[model samples]
Target: MNLRRLTYLGIAVCIASVPVLAVPAQPRSVEYRSPVDLVLLKNDTWLVVANQTSNSVSLLETKSGKILDEILCGDHPSAIVACLDGQHILVSCAHSGQISLIQVEGGKLNEIHTIDVGFEPTGLTVAPNGKTAYVGLVATGEVAELDLVQAKVARKFSVGAWPRYLTVSPNGERLAVGCSGESKIVIVDLIQGEIAYSSKLSGGINIGHLQCSADGKYVYFPWMIYRSNPINRDNIRRGWVLGSRIGRVRLDKQEYREAITLDVPGMAVADPHGIVMDSSNKRLVVSAAGSHDLLVYRRDDLPWEGVGGPGDLIDPKLMQDRDLFQRIDLGGRPMGIAMARDGRTVYVANYLKDAIQVVNIEDRSILRDIPLGQRPRPSQVRHGEELFYDARRSLDQWYSCHTCHYNGGVNSKAMDTWNDGSALTMKTVLPLEHLDRTGPWTWHGWQEDLHDAMHKSFTTTMQGRPASPREADAILAYLKTDRSPPNPFREKDGSLNESAIRGQKVFAGTEANCISCHNGPHFTDGEIHDVGLGSEEDEYQGYNTPSLTGIYRKVRFLHDGRAGSLEEVLSDYHSPEEVSGTRAMTESELADLISYLKSL
Candidate 1:
């Protein structure tokens, strides 16, 4: 058998023979369209997809699934929605912090205007009147309302941390925003122009897209629940460690919330995203991105009212009924879903395959996969990306690396993986961006070799077969491509503010002594220290010094996620007085220090 060797970040990796694509001498004008979301337009005759990676929108013929034209838009187009007029489309470009207004005429997409909203404009929804639009800004934790008539942002509403998805009521009286970082649904009363209430999910994390019922009575979403139990085979097989759920809550009140487990004994649905309901509201379809399948359920037949216990949410008997539930396996990672007027026909944005999959919900069969365009040959990084998002790598297809480290970022939850010779010791997930620079792996700083760490994560943490040497190399190559998003707190030119500049001196000063541990290119000394936050159950003596890069993106602070904010971390836990034996930081100093950290 032939073998190949590749070096990534100075680490030599040997792998099985695989064809490597050569880079073009000159940069290509067109890029790969990694479609993330789509919407039907013009009486379902055309489809528009938000090409996430390409930063463009692709207009396609619905019947033939042929690309009519690709219109360039803002950066990182995350979501798309058609307006009430059916001729205008709204796409939220996350990274660029702008909304691209597209006009559809003669089966072609034209970018009419680009409105600067704010940072990380993701989830988008248009009101019934089509005069107003709501977008969720992830970095700032707020939702901006766009006045479509003026093609500008009218006002913004503070919802919560990491507002990733939003859905407006049929009557346009309320908006349900999915705040993924906080694991809650914030209801914004549009008439009153304020937040009515927020329904918190006890153990929910990675909240998926939100959808409102046609009648405007309830909102539905898919999310994952992490059970704080010891990581073991029995607990994992029984769905106690990490599980998937579809939750429902009434728009009128805060107390009427219900959830049903999508996992059944051995078989589990992981990373449930992109949900849709039939016209009659009888069928509910969800794309299980991690599991690489679609779960179709008879919504009326589901026992959503007081079904199961705490750890076990699903009734075992429900799994035996095929009429109530059916799983349709799609090869690529299925994301956003769009239903045609003929409710039985559902279109899905297949992320990994770079195509739009048309499926018939009635027969639970795939009609066809419409490739967006010609894709480049498979490279090592692309191959690793598939494996990273592929849940089949786990036992029974429960979860994938994307489940915890979402989009190569943190999941805002503490998980016990039994990595450090102890059980039930939960540690907050560390972001994977610039992962190579932040090693020695694990919270305990025990794993010295990155290759061995990746192997252990698959075999022990996922409770699945260990990845081969070649597979590990591919995964590492993919990680190299994962870079941290631009910090929104910084200035437009990426310069630090006055407060951050002042705080930088304080960080290096002996009074704070932060630079002693967190001083490097990635803002970490790459060493372990005893900060006195350990517990009796902890097997490790000290925790690893975490990198402060993109620290503002995190919702929870500290190793165990005890601190809810940077202020809490400085005041309540891990204070300068406690860590460095210096005097407590004053409120003014703390504010400046936090500002500097966020600027990083």
Candidate 2:
């Protein structure tokens, strides 16, 4: 009961509320279309959208919005779950790694099987007796499972480095997944298929869509914070980088607490790209997708509970605001969320208004919205086929490193401060289709390559100014052949991550030593470590030790946001000695050394 008296008794039970700042329910001009992901089959009366760049999967009928069948496939489909008794489906194509299986019967969609397995498959679930299906693959961190009575592949496991979402718990044994290029979640152990546990939903930033609840206890996730500062002035090249919240993570005792967190005062836009769990009205649905909206929380208003330890969730008044959820203006950009039989009605898939919005979790309402096509984006294909992209080169509206690394950025906070010698603020963005084998770019390594780090991040930090230089070589040829977005927490092949195995025994032991330099596989051993917060006499004295991959969508800590959080970047700037490599520990061992640098 001590750790500062349980952090003053969990901030006096989370400062008794007082954190509401939402306001953006007045722009209703809805024509709808942008369905990224949704599925509420059968009981909710069918809704299935996975339309990424319009390859197609429509089929909505939830009480008359019509469009009861679009069913095309391949070119892009991107993730969908349900199976057999629910009417068999399983789609995941995202630029063709393929995995269709459709078989709806009476209400259309009968395409049976397609199976390919490794290049894009971008996450899809169905193994709770639905006859095994997993998928994920995304540039191979691996997962594939499948064998729905011999549909194919049946086994393959790896787990980390870029999984987007998996979930199969409600007594299905286990299989958590969620890993957007390193920062941990990887549970896996479904009847010993492997990886028996690991957690740290990137409190540093960049972890997305992990959802689970039909009685699995709790697991919802979708965080992204990508900060950047550069020299602030309400955005020098882009830094605020908001939205995307809902951490939760409890699986009996896997831990990592402080459930909900997303405030939207004035214009912060909750962001959150997808999360689902209506579980018949306990409610959780959140695809806050950059403030276009569709959020809702309930679950007795989630906040710190048993799984609350790492800096034990410093009470920022329990976050959650995008106007207290229950709002639906499905005009465009609403990532994903799914539920059917008894979750009290749910379904949303509106990536830039391709359409599919049938919510109504007990009057928080929206109920009918079914349009689909022309540059939409959702996939989990199965025999339909016809996805093409050209919404003016969709990076959502181009120039997107997700605006400044949002969704795939984990959970951001802010602070770019011009560059390296400034200190460091979640400075990693790796995951580039296996990142040309991790080369030299920012954080002091400074770009000596990758086309001069894509001409200083596409002409001075993504300004683009009418791009040129061949549209930055077609956006670095589409970020080196995109498709690495599905890692669903890879691990089922040997495990590790009990606070990173007690944070690698205290990050290489000796109270907070931090392995002297951080180590490899992108955890960073690139060098440079001064710590005294730089600028003693400049000339790059030290700092460049970035790359924790998706460092929990970093927002601000040093390099200029000057430690706004992450337990104040380790209990007020690395405590141990004074030389300043910053890591002496204390404060519950710096939340187990940041839960072991987020289990990377």
Candidate 3:
């Protein structure tokens, strides 16, 4: 028999042998009172850290190592940037979908205004003149230009899905945005009103918190290796996955397209974030979020460079000797980072521990821990989110749930975990949203309970301890609260537009019937169907129908990521009926249908 027949036979035999009630219950839950970004005051006296988990920003006195204040803000404050005025700060609150512009006068802050941007506004970059600011909207794949003069969003420009970080050129004319959701960087020309470049990166996932060089010559970010060829997890011990890396993009006219990759061969410095370079631009301080450690490396210290050059190289094994690498343990999940003017002290936002650990770059040692003033122990959702971003729960502190989810979202990469007894079969990272309403977890519909999936992830994927009963409840609470972000296709009145309404009728029709499988409030019928789509390594007779509420947010489509766009979703990969229906659909009608689906 062929592979398809074998797959059907295997599922039939397995179904006949096991019953639904036989599946065991598993406990789990997930948190970052997650500090996603930070900035230093112009005077350099205090550093402000955005606590996405706490909905607060903590001010730390650098000299005294004291928490001067923890000012309450909107929900999920992800990014903070110090404007040129020295008294103004722009903070992006992700959960609230607003950018709060706070004015600091004398010694206090004045809430100037909160401009409602869109869903999941992440990184922001202020112009040197402080006249304009650009905010990255993660969900809508657009960047909003905020005019500080008017205290409002001026214009929004499309970039890519999940524009996580924004870095402005020194001249303030060019903007480089790290589109993490799509694993690419989009360079926008501010004056011309167009994208100058959209460079696809290698092994860059959840790429955020970018820092430009002093001369504005390049941008550096921490990324991970997911393997190029289709491969199994068996080679994980051989560095096939969970590999450490630092990527650099040269922007000079001579080397505008040049890319550089650096790594310490065989080292387990996973989940790189919070990177800062010293004044001389030699010493580099990077927070390995997954390992709970800070890596200190000097560019000159690399042994690859010959006598007298910058050693422009791309060797992954230049720093193989462990003793040659200067590393420090932060003992917590570090996310945001800020460096002193002189570059002697580096401040780190320890998201999980609620403290700011200051590291002296000179000796690579922890100078002090400035408490953000810990609140009560994390509640269920809070605890769950912290657990979600934390790597300590994994074996040897290898990586955290954020390694795959990015920020309770998809990683835009595929992996073969052998979870379903399949080898050399890759599955795209499914998004975690509208979990409570969407029943039967995973694409195969193996785990009926979300908590059970969490337990399996911890025990199997992370190779760590199974989730406790309480932990499971906390994680589930977080999943429920982590609703799908507001889709951008809604009308001004928050109702379906005429095109979408028309397309809705088309969707319910028998020829282009989408409601049969994608039905109800969550847009899923909670059923599996053969649908004539199966591969050789697929162990299931059918695939679980997924929710389409935030379908526009996905960079790839289907379980194996065969479709790269929404238009492709209606193309050859679709079932015969859908293909025929879509083929007969007029270009305008097809556009309307797509617009309608995205509005969900």
For residue 148, model 3's alpha carbon misses the true position, in angstroms, by: 1.7
On lDDT, the candidate that comes out on top is: 1
lDDT tens string, model 3, 475-522?
Answer: 778777854555667864689999999889878876677787889997
Candidate 3 overall Cα lDDT vs. reference? 0.70
Worst 10 residues of 1 by lDDT: 1-10
Stretches of candidate 1 exceeding 4 Å from the true structure = 1-30, 306-317
TM-score of 3: 0.84
Q: Could you give candidate 1's per-residue lDDT for residues 1-600 as a string of tens digits?
A: 112221111122333244544323222223467889999887788998988876668888989877776655777889999874889899998876788888888865666677987578889998989889999989889999999888988999999999999899989999999998888989999999999999888778888888888888899999998888886678888887889988888898776568888886677788998998978888889999998899888887776753343346466556788868888999888999998888889999998888899999889899999987667678899889999998889887788999999898898888888787788888899988888889887888988898998988998889899999999999999999945566778887889999999889888889998999998988998899888899889887888999999898899889889989999998768788988889998888899999999888
TM-score of each: 0.93, 0.32, 0.84
Give the root-mean-square deviation of each candidate in angstroms.
7.6, 21.4, 12.4
lDDT scores of the candidates, listed in order = 0.84, 0.56, 0.70
Instruction: By lDDT, rank the candidates, best first.
Output: 1, 3, 2
Error of 1 at 89 (Å): 1.2
Better of 1 and 3 by lDDT: 1
